[model samples]
Target: MKVIVGLGNPGRIFRTTRHNLGFRVIDKFRKRNGLPEFKSSKEFNSLLSRGSFNKEKIIALDPKNLIVIHDDLDLPLGKIRVSKAKGAAGHKGVQSIINKLGTKKFFRFRVGILPQQGKPQGVKKFVLKSFTRKEEKIIKRVVEETVEAVEFSLREGLERAMQDYNK
Candidate 1:
């Protein structure tokens, strides 16, 4: 089965924050695809669902896919990266999943929220703050793109999704 994991902190406070956009994307997919509601479990820190898209079995991986969607100070906003194996780059959420999963074979659909570069504090602040007015517009576009990328990921393949998105 193809797993789509979106990383973000758990809690109502983090619900609408940019840091949780990945989570939002996954939630969106669940709603759009008519998947089941999110049932919280220790193994999966966040909400979850399971269903198919375009005839492919798509799993709404919670805590399972969280790590892969972590912060990448290396990537700019609007760029989504897919990887099977890599360090957390200091993102606690990602580190948590990697520690729990015991394997990187799963898919991670990472939405870049870190500032383009410079000002090391950007990363520090990103995970804590909400998106700005301007960034909200950009983030909407990125989220839409994320949805498309994910749909394509299932229809196409992980490698193709990587090549197309990890640019």
Candidate 2:
């Protein structure tokens, strides 16, 4: 089974932060696919929704068949990239997952959160801050496109998705 994981801190306050883009994408993907609402999974320490896509069974979390969606500070806002077997590049959340899974071979759908102006002064504070009204509009579009990229990855293949969306 394929497992898609959206990494983010768990809390209402983080719901709209740049750091929670992963959660937002997963939420939208779930709703768009008509999956049931996520339920707490103690064994996995995450919210999970189980279903099938294109006749393939999909569970919420697993290592071998994993696809992680998360925010990337390096790329410009609204940019999307699909990669596999790559290092976390200082993303603590991704590093934590790598430590737990003992490998970096899984797929990743990275949505850029950096503004076009440049990197922010304080990385921690910037990531946790809510997007400005102007930025929110861009984020909305990125989320939609990211969702489509993910669907393309599943329908076609990771390499093809990377070629198409990583432009």
- Highest TM-score, which number? 2
- TM-score for all models, in order of appearance: 0.82, 0.94
Lowest summed lDDT across 10 adjacent residues in model 1 is found at 62-71
Residue range 71-164, candidate 2, lDDT tens digits: 9999888888899999998789999889988999999999899998899899999999988899899999999998898888889987888888
Question: What does the lDDT come to for candidate 2?
Answer: 0.88
Error of 2 at 117 (Å): 2.6
Regions more than 4 Å wrong, model 1: 60-68, 116-125
lDDT of 2 at 87: 97
TM-score of 1: 0.82
Model 1: colliding residue pairs: 67-94
